[model samples]
Target: MLDAALKQQLQTYLERVVQPIEIVASLDDSAKAREMQELLQEIAPLTSKITLTERRDDNERKPSFAITRPGTDISVRFAGIPLGHEFTSLVLALLQVGGHPIKLDAPVIEQIRNLDGAFEFEVFMSLSCHNCPEVVQALNTMSIINPRIKITSIDGGVFKDEAEARQVLAVPMLFMNGEYFSQGRASVEEILAKLDTAGGARKAEELSTKEPFDVLIVGGGPAGAAAAIYAARKGIRTGVVSDRFGGQVLDTLAIENFVSMKETEGPRFAIALEEHVKHYEVDIMNTQRGAKLVPGKLIEVHTESGAVLKSKSVILATGARWREINVPGEKEYRNHGVAYCPHCDGPLFKGKRVAVVGGGNSGVEAAIDLAGIVKHVTLIEYAGELRADAILQKKLYSLPNVKVITSAQTTEVHGDGKIVNGLSYKDRSSGDTHKLELEGVFVQIGLVPNTEWLKGAVDLSRYGEIEVDVRGQTSVPGVFAAGDVTTVPFKQIVIAVGEGAKASLSAFDYLVRSSVEEKELAPTTAAA
Candidate 1:
């Protein structure tokens, strides 16, 4: 299954294995099984440490393999072809299981080693989902750390019937033991926080004890990462706190507009950005949400976990998220048939009918993408005409399995208590109600800025976007905002990056002009 270049790369990576490992496969006489066998055979020769074996009697899940050391009870399994976005996850599992040292913090490794109880985690994920690899890789790493933990990354794309039976309409759906744990993207820290009951309070207490930063950037999106790099380069104390480092960027499918780079994936871009920032001496606290902001001499950013982080100057770079339709049954049926990411959850609705709400670029793109996957795609738009670009609209209309309805409003999502059965809409022109009998509803109504948390702390626009001046400075002194959360004209990654740099520079200027410490440290001569 691997190409010549890939074989060389795999061999090089396998050279890091310090211990022998085993691949115990549970498979049947199926095409996927044969493909997996071929993949395993090709990989085994790359490293002599790998010992491959098979079982005649398989478990409930077939076409799967487990990675483990000879004497270790720990396991990391893949229930399908772990290629596509999950290829990295497969590589990481092999390396870690073969005794290659993980590059995690010493404290986190220690915590995992000392973790209590047995955890059997099953993650239903799609190979096309860029977000699933992170969750799967995180669980796999944890499984290697603690022998009591076991992680199985299941491919919903291959096991469509099983996904439908479990009512898993979203990719990266998690199940602990046998009960549903969560849906959507998650990091190792987030997963650990949920597994341990008192982890939040303990983390809060630990974070609260840190010394104040000269520049504290909240949120770890592209904008926050840029701000961090700029501030850290100035030889000042810099720190960043975010619930998720990638933000909406992780949900993004592909980026063709980013300058220099012709085309790239969002998850890859976000990782490179994070890694670039890490090259500096900046402190990054991931999986921590800043709930409230206090504007003062030493601005305090209070986290949802009750952690109080103070800084001389603050930069708000929290990005945006998919806006919900908020119609009836929308909330109740979320992940049960309603989804936001077309790329991640599109395969789940294969051979079924689905409706994409909204008429703009995202909506049209979703309808076009789903038309090839689902049986039929009904595109509903609130406006009189589609706001998508001319080419996209043309392409959308050319699809045979796609239908576009303009001047229609989504009234309610219809579900039979378990999963979505259909949807209700209203025609603006005819003043009539319409219902679409479908299995899934994909909401693509654009984005809402993640600025609700800063409501009372800063001056926000009517749409809840932080009001920033030309310098990216907010209403409050020593507090700046950037990216989608601010009043930026265009919401692009490049623009966010520039705004972030501007915000960091503005914050540094404010700190030097007001603080006695900064004044003493400031250079006496003018710019050369």
Candidate 2:
């Protein structure tokens, strides 16, 4: 239960008076509902709160509240304790409820209004892909502006069948009324134009005027982008397909030691890297997901938008995703206070208390880095001792703000409204239970390669990593794998980039050799 003082503070915070805010609490207890009611009443004369019991019949959906206030036309729904990006969504919803239009300029608005009839659009996304958020936000905004657009956004791995059915080979795909539209970041104007063309009553296939690409690389991370840069530099027709423009690099919090650069954050570093890649002849489809891989003498990539890309060679650079603990609230708190990447989400919790789960090198490093930024860092280890190197362990323990708790396992995360407040854990040493108060939790358990879809098509390690030779060649002759997903000892950004470049070169060589072999075989038959 919240104390009266805290309730008064929340009430005052609610009364800023310009916009209305509503919090939909999904709780089972009636006593908690009463507490919320009392809290709302104290928020001055402006705010109006509606309970979930009053609106819905069932409890499985949890009780949510709609908040409205005087002089505001917008109604915001605070769904199940908003945190992380959800917190940002909550604020926007409140602003919207207060009649604040998240204005898209005339051109964007015009295109949206002109979209005809009902359309179902599905976009595949990856959290690790930096560009996924932008695509999601754009589509979400479009949905809010136009009701005709029904957007179904699914996680790529989670919705494998849907992806395979549509032949999705990458992330952030935009599927138009049952047909593939376009991949990558289509501007508001471009989408409108494409939609208009597809929705026209007459059904005639219009040949695209865009020049054909020499090499169409799938995935973005370090591998794909590096391939794009190298291929473009080599004067090969190169284009990149990715749901997120930045790939795995964006999730890194701080990269103090990526070769060539002194220090950089993951997102900023990726932005710069992306810009450099685009400086060449590379055309990047940053928002499109790969829908299918068409096999032949030459590889053809069919995207979600039905844009068939015929390439002499294709490079598979789709990276890995973070593995979850399966603990309660793990999914709910993702991208909120609970995070998978220390590089991307660490700064958000600066000067605040936080926890780091896992005792591996990644976890130890993350805790040490976070200790420098946050007020304190609590290291939770499920094992009896740290799994990191001795030097790293020493460095981690040396930090004044860092505390290593061995043989501890997180049982559940506890939070209310905004961000993560704390978590409950079990002390393995004593089998004692204890609750901890923390502002954020960084998960560094490990990653699962994004290769499950490539079963039988490629050689994968027992650990699920793509099995690659010294030359980055997979079991398949023409195909190659790189980055963390490959059986590369190191999962560093520089290594991934290097492997990607090597793989691209290998693919190029394979294409050349295959062409030569075909030519040789043809001449003997003709001569005979």
Candidate 2 global Cα RMSD: 13.0
TM-score per model over all chains? 0.96, 0.58
Model 1 regions more than 4 Å off: 516-528
Model 2 TM-score relative to the real fold: 0.58
- Report the lDDT tens digits of candidate 1 across residue range 1-528: 799999999999999999999998888988998898899988988889999998759664788999889986967899999999899999999999988889889878777887889889999999889899989998999988897888889999777788888989998999999899999999888898888758778889999999999999999999999999999999999999999997888889889998999999999999999999999999999888889999887899999989999999999999998999998899999999999999999988889999999998989999999999999999999999999999999999899999889999999999999999999999999999989899999999978998878888899999889999999988998999999898788789999999999999998988877877767878898788
Q: What does the lDDT read for residue 87 in candidate 1?
A: 93
Model 2 misplaced regions, further than 4 Å: 1-214, 302-308, 341-353, 368-376, 388-395, 398-401, 414-422, 426-439, 523-528
Candidate 2 lDDT by residue in tens digits, 227-260: 7787787777787877676676666656888877
- Compute the lDDT of residue 420 as modeled in candidate 1: 97
lDDT of candidate 1 at residue 277, scale 0 to 100: 96
